[model samples]
Target: MSSKEKLNDAFSTISDSFLTECARPLKKTVFQKRICRLLPLVAVLVSIAILLPIAVFRHKSDLIPGRWTLISHADETVRKEMLVESAHKPTVSMSMNYNKLPAEQAEAVGFSPEKDPCVELFAQWFYSQITYDYRMHFSLFQKEAVDYSFTSEAIERGFTFESALDKLDTVTSHFYNGIKYDLFYSLVSCKDLTAELENTQGQFYKSIVRCGADPAKISMIVEYTFDDIKLIMNERFLNTSPDGERFNFMFYCYDGHWYIFETEMENDFSIDVLGKDEDWLSILIVPQECYGRVVAVGRGYLLLDNGEYFMTLDELDLKVGDYVHVSFTGFQTKGRFIADDGSTEQKVTCNNLLTVKLAEPSTPSEEERSNE
Candidate 1:
């Protein structure tokens, strides 16, 4: 299918999943499709805003009979405030016409195959929030990108910056039906671009973010800058080899758009690609007072430190002493099931498929192997 079609399909999936998930008891409030009902009011306001500009220009047509200047000089007295306003709301005044562009064109812009896998993933994840469902859907992941548009509106409504920040905290706990990737964003630089665009020039903000699937580990750092909606990502990949070296990835792009059409990430560690190139591992840490039957391999729950257990989605050939690695897709909480004897058990369900070697046996040490 076409790129736009694919993007629509991906959003359709997210929308459908949102509906399906929202119907569930506790999932309803997490991310409801409430925007549909509110969109009419927004549309009316936008229509009026658009019309007001046209009406003003039409009345002033006599004054500007020939040509209009695209860029105007900033008054020195207000230049600092103007710069702040420009940086605060950087999205180009003109809406990007991605629909008219070919799918390849959209893919070519800004996106590169050689880019750092982590950077691409971050870009996609960050862009996904901006595109599908607006900033509200950002709660699905560890909050990273700041919605200046929303912030601007909030400030205009007379809220203090600190209050606005607190008000934007929508996600109370990280529990949602979406990809389980965590992103921690740190603002690196916000400055005026020295090398300007032909028709457009404004302040650009650079953010250095540590993003990856594993909440415990920072896999890679992505340096990305955005001037309005145009995003450029400097991708870097973390080599899983013994050296743990990192390398710059150069993905060819068209006009430097770099936005991913779909949310399916290339570096999402949870999506298991079956082969020797696997980067995920699973191990069974047997509890000291464990007294359970070997009914199934990975068909069990992992006991959390807080006296809670996380159940496995698929069965693993996990023996007590086995240190097996497995790709973890996601999980479901309060996931309950009825046993054969009619007993219901509630637990955190893990979602993953057994791909590589079934429970690799704990091998003897190198010294032991040499002696043998």
Candidate 2:
């Protein structure tokens, strides 16, 4: 028999219903076919969904132009007051495309690696600061770099600023409000620089890396003058490290701009870095006396209404409610002054009480008196 006849004889033994069922076409079910056809379309839709936001964000911050890039979108509100205008007219001409460049004073004065754009940034943006009428230092802090924020990790570890951009209020608190740094020396020099770059791998590296800015900006810079060493600390300590050097500060680049962030030299109200009234007392930053009104008094100490707690000198015999002229140095001989009542508060001594008045008190008008 032929192979076709053999197949027909075999099929004839099966039921007609089986034969009929076998004659049906072998094809996918409607539900299966619909799912298969929809998968490619769903995949295309999913791809669009994933890429849409990224495309939008990239479209916004596509480029960081130069120093101090603004992070706001076109629709975002504009900043005011604290906003620093971006300008880069290099004193030592260099390419605008580079990350770092040498500055005038930093190079001419031979600062080694300190001759960076940061120094130039300082020279132009904040020349009045280091050589400031330091008396007004606190009030000037509102002026800033591109963007600013604190690092929680650095603070939690008891390390104040590990090259992170921060506010200078704590450091500024140490300054005799309204004192200028130029009082000690007419000729100021670019003392030192510590430009610490943040690691690209760091969790806190909020850099404009895409725009070619480094993950780390700049960290610390100190300005010092040896003028007051002998007078401030006496001969013995005059041979020491700071030698009554004026200010130690922190700096960093944020949002593509530079900032003279904080003074690392001292924290008068807290546990201080430079302690000892004699160290910074006579080197007064304030042109006038700091006035303190006695709210509370204790043995060898007096508490002022402004929360100033200071140990009194043997010569300063002051009483409560007396509007005494006072000054504060960031330095303290002791971290905390223990009171007879077993209490303690940070204080600058009565020597700053303007014990020997420099000028006779002048009577003020009603407006000045009321304002005071």
Candidate 3:
């Protein structure tokens, strides 16, 4: 009935209540403890589920939906040596006049300066036209007249050899390591240019103007840098001197991110444009469904329609004079094509071939042949 008696009673009651709560179900207590232990893992899984798509999208930034390969000359010294071997090979002479065509051919083709804008542009503005006669045995296609002329305006505007070198100095001044400038240079630089060459007689000299970009095909994206920089080069533009040498306006986008495309020395000493060591990489834009007919088949490459050709890795079971349709789904170059020049460091050229099929050749009837 005193204060001590009350305090003792209250302590006993509190101790009993605490023990009773601790003696509750052990299974429920263990389950709650397990959930608490897994909380960090659950949070991590939830975060990954929400961010996986964002990570994938970031990885694929600046990737265009097509395929292309990176090419670089490992050794310029080897290239120069190969050039020496190519020049002494046998060569034949051929000529073409853009201003005037043969009477019979002119009647059928009708590419007069009055009717055709291209013809008129070349004839009225351009001064000289030259032809490139191949001296090699490997013919991807029949030798067509490789000729071009430049307009006076394009010549005046195009880059000269000396001026192009000067522009190269100015452009490279802004370059530093890891700072990408392919797209920036392409946007600001002048792509077309002119160069001088000696005549065939080795007596006189001439200047070549520019052909400009082809309206049919705008430009080809060749180099895609690691920083997602794309270097676009316009379709092949060409000029020629009185001698049988070619001057090409090529965008040197790989090593030198300069604007003034340089002139390449294309002559008997030069490798055939289709042979092995051409810089520009072409995309198979139009499939056979668009327009392709096989005319001839060779070891590694096939001839389509007339001049078009595609190389394959494995030898196709195709034959010459077979009419067929070709289709390409994608582009891929796996292995390297080793040149016979005996270089230890071979070139890494891709075998990006189109998946093609062959069909039975259609035979023309006697009447059809006679009509032809």
Best by lDDT: 2
Specify the poorest-scoring 10-residue window by lDDT in model 2. Answer: 229-238
What are the per-residue Cα lDDT tens digits for candidate 3 across 16-70? 7688877877455231111001111111111111001112113222333211111
Q: What TM-score does candidate 1 get on C-alpha atoms?
A: 0.19
Between candidates 2 and 3, which one is better according to TM-score? 2
TM-scores across all candidates? Answer: 0.19, 0.23, 0.20
The local lDDT score (0 to 100) that residue 369 gets in candidate 2 is 89
Off by over 4 Å in 2: 1-105, 108-198, 201-250, 253-257, 262-350, 354-372
Q: Whole-model Cα lDDT per candidate?
A: 0.26, 0.31, 0.26
lDDT of 1: 0.26
Q: Which 10-residue window in model 1 sums to the lowest lDDT?
A: 232-241
Model 2 scores a TM of 0.23
For each predicted model, how many residue pairs clash, with residues at least 3 apart or on different chains?
17, 14, 4
Ordering by lDDT? 2, 1, 3
Q: After superposition, how far is residue 111 of candidate 2 from its true place, in Å?
A: 8.1
Off by over 4 Å in 1: 1-121, 127-148, 171-196, 200-372
Q: Candidate 2 on 236-331: residue-level lDDT in tens?
A: 010111223332223444445544443311121112212224334334433234665666554334556565544333334555666666654422
